[model samples]
Target: MSKSIDYGNMMHRAMRGLIAEVLEDVGANGLPGEHHFFITFDTRHPDVEMADWLFDRYPSEMTIVVQHWFDNLIVGSDGFQITLNFGDTPEPLAIPFDAIRTFVDPSVEFGLRFENQDGEEDDAEVVDLPDLDLAEALDLDKVEDPKPETASDDPAPAKDADVVSLDAFRKT
Candidate 1:
C-alpha cells in the first residue's frame, strides 16, 4: 500500500500560522485600509473561554467580528484575547488557536476554513482548505511571476491564481 502524505494536517498548521501572522499585524498596527477579520470558533472547545451568557447564546459555535469597537486585542502564540460588547456590556474572551473553525478578511476576499477536530474519533479525515491566495497578505505584487497559459483547442475554465490544491501529494 502506498503511503499518503498528511498534507492536510500540514496545511492546517500553516493556515493557523497565517492567522497568527494577520492577528499579530493587527495587534502591532491597527487594521490597515479597511482590513478586518471575521473569526469563527467552536465555543464548546476546551480551550475557549467566554461569559456564561455567551455560551448560553452560542452553545456550539460563535463568530466575532474584529473590525471596530474591539478593545485590547492581544495575539499570542497559542491564543488571543479581546473585549467585545455583548448587549451593552463589555465581554472579554480568550480563544485558543485550535478551536478556530474559520478566519476571513472579507475586505480582500481572503479566507481559511479549519476542520472542527475537537472530540473527533477519526484522525484520517482530510481537511479541505479555502482559497489561500495570500499574495495580498504578504504584499507580493511585484515579486510574483504571472503564469503562462497552455496552448489547447479548448479554453481553460476561469479560475483565480490564489486558489491552491494539495491533491498532488495524496496517494491514488
Candidate 2:
C-alpha cells in the first residue's frame, strides 16, 4: 500500500499561520484603514478560555468582532488573548488557533472557514460574503480625519493637493 500526503491538514496549518500573522500585525500597529476582523471559534474546544457566563451563553461556538474597540491583543504560537467589550463589560478570552472556525474581514470582503470532519484534521474553505454591507450592518457613521500636516512651515495644503504632491518634495 502507498501512503498519501495529508494535504488537508497541511492547508489548515497554513491558513492558521496566516491568521496568526495578521493578528500579530494588528497587535503591533493597530488596525489600519478601517480594517477589522470577525473571528468565530469553537467554545467547546479544550484550549478555549473565557468567562463562565460567556461559555454558558455560547456553549458551542461564539463570534467576536475586533473593531473600533479591543485591548490586550497578545498573539502566541498556540493561541491568542484578547479583551473585548461585552455590553459595556470588558471580558478577556484566550482562543487557540485550532479552535478558530472562521475569520472574516468585511472591509475587503475576504473570509476563511475551517471545516472539522468527525474529530479529524480540518479542511479550509474560502468563504466570500458578497452582498454583506458592513456599514449598514454595523450601523455606524464614518469618521474622517482632517488633512495631515506635511512637515511644512507654510499652511497645510488641501486634501487633493496633498494627494497629488509627493512628501519628499514638500517643504519642511
Candidate 3:
C-alpha cells in the first residue's frame, strides 16, 4: 500500500507562515491603521516563555491583543518576541509558531485556526466499542424501526442537494 502524504500538516504550516508575515509587517510598519490581532496560544507549549506569574495565571491557554499597548515586537524565523504591560510591569513574551492556536483580525473578519501539536488539553472522551461482525454487532430486535417521515399536508419544500442524512451510519 502506498503511504499518503500529510498534506494537512503541510497546509497548516503554510497558513502559519501567513501569521509570521503579518507579524513581520507589524514589526516594521507598526500595525497600520486598525489592523490589530487577537492571537490565542497554548501556554503549556514548551517553547512559550513568559513571566512565572503570568504563566501561573494562564496555566493552559491565553489570548493577547496586539494593539496600542505592546512594544519591542520582534518577529523571528521560528518565533516572535514582544513586550506587554502586566499590572504596570513590562513582561517580555516569546511565543513559537507551533504554540499558536488561532490568529484573527477582527477589523476585516479574517482568521485562521491551527492544530495544537503539544498534546495539551486533550479532553476528548474516548469510548471503546466491542469488535464483532456486522450481523452480531447489531441488536436488531432491541432497536425500534425508524418511522418514515410523512409527507406534509402542504407540499414539502424542495430538498437541497447539499443536505446530508446521517441515518446510514446510525446503529439502528
Clashing pairs in 1: none
In model 3, residue pairs whose N, Cα or C atoms come closer than 3 Å (at least 3 residues apart or on different chains), thus clashing, are: none
Global CA lDDT computed for model 2: 0.72
Cα-based TM-score, every candidate: 0.66, 0.74, 0.65
Give one digit per residue, the lDDT tens place, for model 2 in 1-172: 6399878888889989999999999999888887878787889999999999989977987777677667799999999998875645678899999999888787888878887778677778776567645454333342223233232224443221100111111123
Kindly report which residue stretches of model 1 are placed more than 4 angstroms away from their true locations once superposed: 1-4, 117-172
Model 1, range 15-67, lDDT digits (tens) per residue? Answer: 78788888888777877877767676779889898999889977987767666
Residue-level lDDT of model 3, residues 20-74, one tens digit each, is 9999988887777677676767789899999999799779776676765667899
* Model 2 TM-score on a 0 to 1 scale: 0.74
What's model 1's lDDT at 64? 75
Q: State how far residue 129 of model 2 sits from its true place (Å).
A: 3.1
- Specify the highest-TM-score model's number: 2
Best by lDDT: 2
